[model samples]
Target chain A: MRLRNLGFVLLFVAGFAHADTAPFDLSDAEHIKAGHKRFNKTCAAYCHGFQGSGGRAPALNAPDGLPPEQMFTVITEGRRGAEVMPPWGTSFTPEQIWELIAYIQSLRSTAPAAP
Target chain B: MRLLESIRTSLLSLIATASLAATAAAPSIDQAGSADPTNWPQYHRSYNAWRYSPLEQIDKSNVKHLKVAWIHQPGNITHGLQATPIEIDGVLYYISADNNVWAIQADTGTTLWHYVPKLDPIVKEVFYGSASRGVTVGLGKVFLGTLDGRFIALDQKTGKALWSTQLTDQRNEAGALFSSPPQLAGNVLFGGTTGGDQPTIGKIFAVDAETGARLWTFEIPKDDLKSWPGESRKTAGSSAWMPGTYDPVSDTIYIGTSNAAPDYHPYSRLGNNLYSATVLALDPKTGKIKWHRQEVENDSWDFDSAYEALLLKRDGQDLLVHLNKGGFVYVLEKNTGKIQNVWRYAENLNWTDGIDKKTGKLINPVRPEVEKSKLLCPNLLGARSWNHGAYNPKTGLWYTHGMEVCNYITSAPEEPGPKPINALTLGLEEIRLTDPPGKKADGWFGAFDPITGAQKWKIRYDMPGLCSTLTTSTGLVFTGDMRGNLYAYDGDDGKTLWQFNAGSACRGGPISYSVNGKQYIVIPTGLGSHAPGFLAGAFPGIKDLPGGATLIAFTLE
Candidate 1:
């Protein structure tokens, strides 16, 4: 009986966690500027290149970047196995994470036109 | 019919016994202190970490006739096989990326067995810490330090798991994985983890090789926690990430330590971080420090002293030669960690006005500031990367690769962290590669008088050569480069003897050994490390350089 109740609790938690979009305005200009500063200090110096174009790690501005829901999940709780990346849940606040998402979207929009 | 069967069984038993006796005739790796001409028994070929083979069968005259005998391709080339292969009896053993162990015939590239470790599914540290440098073979068992936090021993004969020991918590500490092979010191084998770049204070542990029991643990950071201010000591890093060499004469294990936390920014960690960027001589039995020497006091440039220590005896004095990534070579007394001499090795050092040659006192060293970009000479690629250089007693010269490059670094303050574990607190806003003061960015491979800092002969490379240099008794020097070309030079005067393009970057160490009277040259070829990616902006061709994982063995035709 307890196992069944626990399974239901897990299902309920999963349902609320999967969101279609971020809580804040990812299209906001100020949000992206704040995130650009954060990304440069942490991510851009080494792993992901400046503007998240790519370095040792994958490019965040690629055309097929992760969706809003998946991006939130990966950033909140790091993903391992083939997709290997560290979690950022404990480091940043929920509001700050949303700002990073906005900056990532901006990078994609500002990427150069292909030949 | 029964009598005939009994006679045949007896004959088979006799043959098996004879084979055992014949193999025993050889000086087993565990019994012998150093690697003989026929076998490469240890990580740096021996406890001293010389990376040199005394075999003279293949010399400069006949090295041109050398041909590729065989090639073994490991299918899982995730980050590329960056291990130096080891040989015992007639079997060659190597650990590829993700801790996959393979045993192949030393003469031919026949695969005998392969051990693939099932790592934790949730650990994200495997990508940057992918390549397993090599494996330890002794006590009739092969030992591997995994990407996750386990030290495992496998049956050397069949490549089966013998025992496993959980050393560190890879989940909590993301960068605390093992990228180097465990070095076996007598009955105990010691291993270190990579927490130098992360927040956790790094640790090194010694374990019993036979039973896989914990012996003792040694932490690189200070015990009193006085070096760091505030709560920074709780997470400040001083990683011990490389294998150390043993000195039987002094009965001590000498190992080097990496840089402090927040590699570039040093506000959090104030005083000279006692043990970071230092070398410690420890008691092998108790794992206690005997003597220690801090190479760089408060190293703010990521200049790790975490390279191998080459033991040598000069004028009846036991001395050790250690090269720091900060572009200087130090000679220390092996018995007691006394700095006998210090000389600059790389020419493009602008981090400091100059260092006192003998006393090693800094002369107006440049300090980084918040939000201000300071162009440091070594950069973090290091004036010299972690890959090793060769010291040949025969030629009386050290063959090494000196990278003449610089990086523009801008520092920024880190927010006070009770932050998440596995988070790197590198206080850097931007790090871009650029050329040095007067020269264009390039690499120089040369032969030099180690003690006097005199260059005998030098060769220039468009891009830096990243492989560990190897020297042999036959007066030949071998090293691999970024463009996949393996060049051999005359150890005496640095003349190009032979060269071969491997079609993939040769980023692993080259070794020499003999099997059944035929000498063999083996080098693991691959290129997927952070150095190549970090250096992409400076070198044009590196952006498109290919990567592969193959063990190529060469023998004279």
Candidate 2:
């Protein structure tokens, strides 16, 4: 009977640990999906091309992909080139920035395998 | 009886004569005072544009305890206020957006008089924007240049118009409109800004101060047929949007010119466009060019040379220092157009390899596939825009805010299909992220070692856009950001001493003055072309910021 009680207790403890780790567990699939949604909504195909290719904007899916922090700074702070890019920090949240990063990461892997 | 009557009549006549003399000797306006520390006269304290005030009441020890004295919210919602108020006696005189001039009590900040010029029926159709940086005072009259290209003189006491004259005939494309205050020497010196993409010519005029008469005009692109007697007549459009500085001792006026028209394409207008991107030294009396140095030759990047040319004397030698839009700080001998030194204040600028020492020519080669997609540093708007910079003789340091960014430009074979429908279409495209991001490979403030052409110190900021700097005798450098925070830094070192949230981006320069033995610093805060686009996203918490104008003054308690 004691042995049976120990098995039941272990199961209860395992369930609690799984629930606690759920919020922190960002699956790769989920991250890429969230990022794709953000890129389509905010940027659209107008500047960044239909598949993160180079056009009026630059190609983001390169070998030396943008660092996560740098990507966040560009979106939040905006780029200063020949003209000025409107900043996104006011319109978007910190979580949204991370989502955009995930989308950029997805583009890197989706690109043709390097030589 | 007859003798006594005659004597009484003579005595009455003598008393009447004495009263008339006393009235004539006193100034017409009681608001006029001479040699008073409480008044700010002329554009930069005096006609010399020194920007130095003798008031030392607000020293470094007491500046920390400064508080707002009186805030005059003009509530003028047309555009930004770029004018520095000129105080005479105890009354302050200034011009605002939409070309409205105002006179206020310096001590109380109460409006005394306001004058609005009657616009011509055709002026409404002009593409000129509404903004008047400031005005000049001399010979008991205040002088101002209008957006529609008219110069007006007004009575100092009452805001009544004395005389107004059309300075530019825009219909013929001779000149467009004035965006800066008219500088006054023995005469009034002023220039104009042109309509974008228009084939307009820019010229500087020296008009008689007392009588509205044109004395002499200096055309930016000299008529080769007239001046040189040979060469073809070249078209040069250099909009002089900022005010020029004058040197009375030499009787010379230093005027800087803007970029050539159809700015993106250099092929449309050939030849080394003479005065388009140059600083010209002219004789104020004759309007003849004494010497000139083209800062940028065949400038394809819309980099204007039209910033303020500050005249200073270093090492007992008269010198002129100007910040060009192409990211270079040029030091030239004021008397002779000799290039003494040149240095890049903004890093990551790949426009030019370097300036040639012997010829003083900027070796800016056309990039490969330039008409295609070519990445260039210090984009067309320039490292620094129209905002003015300040110099402190005591510290021997020059303070200026600059942009450190590159652009990927694809010049079309012909002009673009059509101008962008609105301001949003004129937005910038993001390039590959720069390496070592935190150093503001985008925008920040830099202090230059004037003598050595070395950057003494630099402080990086988040975004890049228009801003101005002001230096004080108290060893403090004051400047603002597009994020609406005004900052005070040490003059010798770029250290942040204090900061105040101005609630709006500051596009105008700040000035310091004194009243009743109290020192005060005044700055204008509002929306204008100088505001950065990223500000809306960077400071989202303050996004719904209303746009208006106000002059805020601070004094030590």
Candidate 3:
């Protein structure tokens, strides 16, 4: 009975941990497409160049220095002293912001590898 | 019988004297339109805003021999120079991009005096962002509207402060500030504000030309709009950001009003936002609206129809020729808001099918219900920006610059916070996601016949033609482009007769004047501006553009 109770506790812990981890499918075509649309619609052309080249805003096609989580934070809350990059916490939802990060990551992978 | 005769003579004398006083108070339309050939006293070089000079010593035949006479380098200005220097009595007076007034010698390009306004840090940060277009000379003083909402008067000869009065509320939190030059009409100094980017309503202020006292104010109507529902009315913006044209004969001021606020989102401001993107004819002294014609209603695109309304007397009828951001040239009856005719000036206009001639309404296609992306031509940068077009009476043609571009724009949610980090207007976002990007945006400097709606002649360029034009009676047209090339075009055929690379983009209006029998053409050149930066992406060839402000004058060598 003690062993059975311990098994149940372990199962509960595993479920909680799984729930905490966001279920982001990096390889999913639909997820990537949604992100591409959002990024292109909101991010590109005005500040960023047509193909993520530098403009009034910086280039984002190259590899990002920050990790996915940090980028998510930056896109969601925006960094202090950065007036140009407005906080998208209210402009976009959490899922959409995460998707944008995934799209940005895809841009890096799709870009020609550095010489 | 003797007493009665004396009384009647006194009454007749009084009547005659009053008539003389009224006539002297205001210069006739003919006098204002064609000022002394040596003086560019007003913003457009005249009250008619024709931007055409009669000095023709450097005619089509001699224009090829033009060479740089002198270069006035205004070092401290960190932005582009937009001033078309007003030459008065051999002295050239203008303002810098940052609202610093400079009085210089018209002959030698020597800086006589520079007056910089001392403003609080907050005011400087919020209000004075764009370039000052030009300055006004009137009532023995040079009038300059500052970014801190003050209309200041300076001694025309000494550049010393005469009087300074606040035109806007000192506690302005929504960033309403002056962007254009002030116009002196009769005894009043007229100017308008530019705060469409912020949450403020646009207003035009009339200040006393002599004392700099606020005389009358005209606020753009925001209430009782059936289109914009409730709260959006508060954010309605119809800023008169350009110096208007005046007709003393009609006793009317033709002021062009800018787009509505929160530029992109139309759901927030629903109704045909009246007077936001309209041309208003007003009484200069009383601020009463005589008539108004809105060019673009419920402006979703940032198409401000606030360019100078070129007033022309066509076939004995007062006709106002206006080119709007949406790429449409509207010919209206100047006295009445009657649309005489309309034509598509730009080649790639797709935002509307056509204009309803009877109602003066844009025939815009039905917007998608779900707010998907819609492709439109002549994007927010506009087919024609703030660059002034010159009308040549001799050639009977209008010389202007035009752009060809399209935008895939989608509506986003209105920005939530009052002071978002990116305080840019929200709702519509331009997307570059369209497959097979349409032809790269190109530019054209062309002469169009307003009556026929036809392009008579044009010189095409890979880089966008982004500058004002000046036409002279000598059959030579002067214009500049984003690539820093100023061209003297043959006014008849639009052929580039001579070109000079000014080492910077020439965005300011070109003016011509003769000082001591030497005809000189002044072109303001500077590299810094959003138009050039965006065009750099559109045209890959424009690179290594030099920075700083320069006023280059040319004369026949």
Candidate 4:
């Protein structure tokens, strides 16, 4: 009876830790930080501008929010109509690319909020 | 005995006097002030095409004290100005966007004369727009190529048109006479650009310099059957967009041509597609092909071999070095078109395993297969694009800004529907962002040994695109990045010597000249082309970058 009780206690602790550690919802800060890091690594400083306010590339943080999946598609699949945007799917990993999408989404609310 | 001795003395005196006069009248090519190193008289400064200026007044020590002297902004966007201005007698002559030829004062940036052509409206619609690379000044005239298939000679002193003749007949829809400046070698030698979706032909014309009469026209594709084969000419629309280099010593003019039209599909055009994406050496006086070497065979990626073929002599042998959009640098014996060496200076290429040295043919087995994405290196822009490369003879180093990246190409299905205007069929599947193995991620200005095709040194940037290379006699190589910062590097070591923030991306090549013994470096800075549009957004520091076109000139204080 004592051994069985000890096993139950250990199982309860393990389940609690698993639930806490799982990535459920990323905060706005986390998303912004993730996006900013990827942009620096991939886009550099001339096309998108220093602050994502748009220079050569289009403004990413407009009021009309970019769909997260569409943003992912654009960055991964690329748009060939006019602007020669090279697709980034082969160069970057899927998880990292998704992080970029999350970060672009975070910019929608705070980009013009303070300015 | 006295009479004979006096005669010998008189003879010696006469010989010495004649030698002195000959030396005074014609100075050697190396002596300063004889040729006036301060004045950039021709495209590459001299007939030898050495971009190096002998002026050393603006050395490394005083270059840091340089300040802006003047700025001339022509607010128009056709194609960002690519022509390096030719300076003659303190006046600078250059072609601006929209085919306007402007003569500006080299010292003050004052506009002296502006010549604009009245082009046909219908012809202009199908054309790739109009822009002048520069004007060739010879025989007391300024020569320029017009947008609507015409070549005009204007008086250098005045902007008035001296004579105008059709280089290509637009009525027959031959092709557009675009930006490549007409090179004059006693005769006006020019080429045409046509790779549009329409069925047009490309030809190089040598017209009489004085009367503007056709001297000779060499059809690029030597296939006789294709000249009038059945319904259409087989070798139609192989454009030669860039200006050809003239070798007066050898009596040859070398021209590099663009790719076959409908650029995505190569199978439509059978055979190697001669002369398209090839470098042809022709007899300037006769317009006969001396020798020709194709850079890319059956080009499907729109890889035009239209960049300048910089002529140089290395190791006591004359060599013609040409850079292709396919990321390969080919060095050929200028006399025979025999390729001496080939090297892949840019990494991340997967199109071909290697080029055969003996045959000068690419060993590309992975032909364009539909649906399967074939990743190719150098992308459509190639390793180097239309920007002019600078050669510094003192160091024997060729400086060029090179792109190091790859793209995935999948052939698009062709439909008979109204071809979308400006429809580029080659779809870029993905951009390989990582720097090639063992190299830095960003683009670089590389100094290469032209003879051996070995990179002497490279100065890498934090950006992907850079303007053309500019070298000065002060041991400096000047280039700019997409982030608006102009850099002057040590031509010997690729070290950053000086930098100036132009507040926008610099699209044109830089030039250095002197006024009143004061040396100045001029660069056209403003909004130009940029790749990977998210670059500014990815780096928040440059988001509100300034966008205004200005010709920034700097001089030593």
Candidate 5:
């Protein structure tokens, strides 16, 4: 089952416990490369700027800006209302979204980008 | 024997004349756009691709007295309201964001029936946000193309499901959906598949309008092996995403096609990608290409030719006036796809050095190269957005919006991933919006001659007008801006006669129709799309713009 931050009333209907989030290995260059490729191919074209420098959407250039759990949840359960952002969970697996999140984190890190 | 031959020829000529007279007199009742002023029937309102209404009840003399008669709200407005509404007799029909259809009374804001489709969860993955350009109302049925690869028909009266046909294969990770309403020609219904920038093959198809059975499919990219070289053709992003109109005179359908896949990278797929960034005249019954004109070769700037192909007749010749996303407008001979005149609507274009006037060939294009970012004006959105332009027959001018913005683009060789990823397939290292050099970044609306491209008058807006433009026989034009201001302008001189705050930015096509002897002008208000993101670089205040869905109907008080 999936839960979304749709409304305050929906929260009263379902209560569940959360667990410690497993972080995506941002140090892995290959993983960050895959995420960068995905971001360049998809997000950069329309929503975000090139290399997450910021355009229409927020800039993901700062790795410490967002918590892992919050980022994971946001990607998993997308913001209910957005101009263009969609729930990645519908299209990607949890691990794949982490692959995406890790790449976003590497944008502000010392990890080298792919060719 | 010579006398007999001459007699036979004379008889044949007489019969041909009678047949031509009959065809001209017969009303095309089954046609989606029947050229009726009482109803806004099709996307272009009529097959001639003119969004002009003949109703002059509220002319320029009294347009200032226009007042909102009523407003209808279509809930679940995620991408806001972008689809053009259709009306017939006293009934109005429109589709909201999740493919929901609504039937409302034209005179009043009473909801007759509302339908919500059971869509696939994959609908959430549509890169352009599952937007149906609009719905088609004909033959007692309303037709809609959905994001989950289905084309459906609903009973016009009760809004009940009449028949459903799955068009696109949902299993493909590349994700192809229908963004335009199915256009009707005879007993056949045809529409183009969207997701033009995805790693999927694009096709336009014809289906039995009644039974919902597939009739014919024409691949937009031609033969994969012919235009595209090697495996690169596998993901050639060519689609006729926008609605194309039918030309009753030539018995042909005119539609513009989208750009090739991996839009910015010309290094991978060399040669002029046939049919990508092209305009095709098709036989609606068979989906056969009658003639085609490729507007751009190996389109490297993400510019597509898939906008409305407006049809007009001038100088004793039939012509098709098309505005390519690259900003150049091509005037083509109607019978054959020969270029007559090529002009431009964009004020700031640098992707090409110039256009050859005599041969109509693009001259010295500045192609985007790998690792090097070049400033290209009219980025993916082109000179104009998907919101259509209006051609007024009475005023003899074509009205459209033009953007004065550019983008810095670095080309990258992008390939389809091992699996269908969650995003688009653009071959770009980076793309960011920028102001056009030496001038302020602004959008302007203008009136021009369809054949000669002569400007009549123009009005500049702080930001681009994102909604469709509509003209009336009253010599007035209707358009809306991102700031939620709807203006009524003089169609001849481009003078603002009246203005109203629609409460939210208008996105859908503005249309005028009459019900029970009263004419009403309807405009959809809401704004949410990647367009605002593109404007943020030029118009910083755009981020705080209000967004909501409401259809405002206005009539002279």
Candidate 6:
């Protein structure tokens, strides 16, 4: 009985933690600005270039990149098995992570036209 | 007739001298203690890993005239070059960022041959990053550990693949990788596996030099928590990521271990977590632990004892010297891991009250509290990261390059999973604490007495000295920074003698060697790795310099 109840609790947590259920506004200008700062300080310089293009890691500003939901999961919980992307949940809150995602999305929108 | 004879005699003497210098010998394993002016054969250029050269061709007075000899830009590897190129017979052998072996002419920056490992889909997907510390050259072959966990041997003369063996499988448990350069001692090659962040248990291996065969393996204790009796510990992270120093006299490999598993939360794994944050004296043949000393017991902060264990001789007594990321320099008996002295090198450190003189263990006062901000000094990146320090036998001083930053570390409750969310948490999410007062500098370069662990002299920098320190018998010391400035200082008094703007962060391995009677100092300028990323968050003054992977060689003009 106890084991079954614990399983239910985990299921409930997982349900609410879905990427679709992510809170806050990705379209917010202030939120995106805040994320840009965080991303540049933590992620941009190491894996991605400071401009969010790419160096050691893949380019983050691709027009048709992963949805914000998948990005949320990858950012929070590092991809297991192929452990390239480390989990940043402990380092940044969900709100801050969403801000970073928004900044990355903005980069895609502002990307220069390919000649 | 007399004038013609004299001219011939002088010319003959000059010709003989040139021949003798050209045929100079490569450094042997037995000659590690004594300084070699010509060759940089080993990782630390010696078995002791002192990183000190007896060559004084470019001394303090003449270092001002040092100029760029040549610059070799490795094509494929883009982000930082970490390999300390080993020189032999006017040929330097080193591995690039992507596991590509390059045999370049030491005199001219001409690439003789390049060997790139063709990886399968599985290896490609799993092999994450590119940053090899260096390669070991001996037994007529150049040896290196691949990022995909493979031990490979290549022909030194021709970049031909001789033997290859898989060291560790990442699929086992989480995964394991090899970034540390393999140390070749006698007939066996010693190497350590990295992946403490992967949360896998750490291990050290001894491989046969002749054939790529596993000789012996030593696993750090999984549950060394003496306080927690009868509890079987599943995972204890103690990765030996850095290349260890070899002591020929003691016949032991001195290597330091990384932090314990579930890093931030010490509540899960209690006790000293013996051998995790400890240095071990292991027999190279059988990989048996002879003696071990735990520096930090129940390490709340991510203080790994994983730095270069330099073997130094003081007053005719052999001693093993190590600088902990936790901000302490320990002097121990080379034969035994008995602590002779321990001293703090960081200017302001509050992670612990201090190390107990009697126990040789840290007086750890701070414990991981759930959701509570615990400000600690000599932050997570460590007072000193894995950047190699140099020991000058002439001055009896050890030069270390490191940071002096602090952090507010807070850990969450333990959770069960492969990569637990709350295992080890960087307290960046917590409320921002004010920087320590008068912290005009975030980095420091220090020279300390290896015998008494006393600070002889030090210099502060706005940015941390990230590159390994290299010293020469000519009373000149060399180190580099994140701002891409390579500096030459007076070894005794720590005075800046000369500087160079390499146009990028020079944080990789810096080594010196002589080819064709010319002394040259080589430094790799590029930026990549975890420390710089941490600095980006902690210090706002830190610059995001452009990416590079160029090896710049310097000599007196």
Candidate number of the best DockQ? 5
Evaluating just chain A, the predictions reach TM-scores of 0.75, 0.68, 0.68, 0.65, 0.67, 0.75
Docking class of 3: incorrect
How much of the true A–B contact set does each candidate keep? 0.23, 0.00, 0.14, 0.22, 0.54, 0.02
lDDT of 6 by residue, B185-246 (tens): 66778888775544566788788988988999888754444832234144566778888876
lDDT for each residue of candidate 2 in B1-557, tens digit (9 for 90 to 100): 33543454355335334423343332211111112334566565543344555566765666667677777766564555667777765577777776888888676678999888886533433434466788887667888888667888899888899888787865455336776778875555555555322445567777888777878776676554432122222234566677787655566678888776545555555556777788888877787889998887766666778777766666777677778888788888878979888877767677788787567787856532323666666755577767766666667677778776555554432323322111111112222222222343456787776545577788877655355666676778777876677887877777877778877767776777665555677777765543332222222222344445777788776
Ranking by lDDT: 5, 1, 3, 6, 4, 2
List the candidates ranked by DockQ, beginning with the highest: 5, 1, 3, 4, 6, 2
What root-mean-square deviation over C-alphas does model 2 reach?
A: 17.1
DockQ of each model vs. true complex: 0.27, 0.02, 0.10, 0.09, 0.36, 0.08
Ranking by TM-score: 5, 1, 3, 6, 4, 2
The residue pairs in collision within model 5 are B237-B261
Residue lDDT tens for model 5, B1-557: 33653554455446435434453532342232234556687787877777888887889899999999999988766777888899877788998878889999988979999989999876665666656778998767999998887889999899999999998875473668887898987567888887578777788878888889999988887675656888877788788888887665566788889999888887788868888899999998788889989889888887898998887777677788888888889999888989899888898999997678666567999998899988899767888888888988778899998888888888888754544434667788877777888888888899999888999998898888899999988888999988899999999898889999987788889999887678899998888567776666667667567777888999988
What TM-score does each model's chain B reach against the true chain B? 0.92, 0.84, 0.91, 0.85, 0.93, 0.90
Question: Which number leads on TM-score?
Answer: 5
Q: Write candidate 3's Cα lDDT for B240-297 as tens digits.
A: 8888876666767898888887677777777888778899999988988999999998
Candidate 6: regions farther than 4 A off: A1-115, B1-33, B120-128, B222-232, B420-434, B437-441
Candidate with better DockQ, 1 vs 3:
1
Give candidate 3's error at residue B334 in angstroms. Answer: 0.8
Backbone Cα, N, C clashes tallied per candidate: 0, 2, 5, 15, 1, 1
RMSD of each: 6.3, 17.1, 10.7, 16.4, 8.3, 8.9
- Report, for every candidate in turn, its global Cα lDDT versus the true structure: 0.76, 0.62, 0.72, 0.64, 0.78, 0.71
TM-score of each: 0.88, 0.72, 0.82, 0.74, 0.89, 0.80
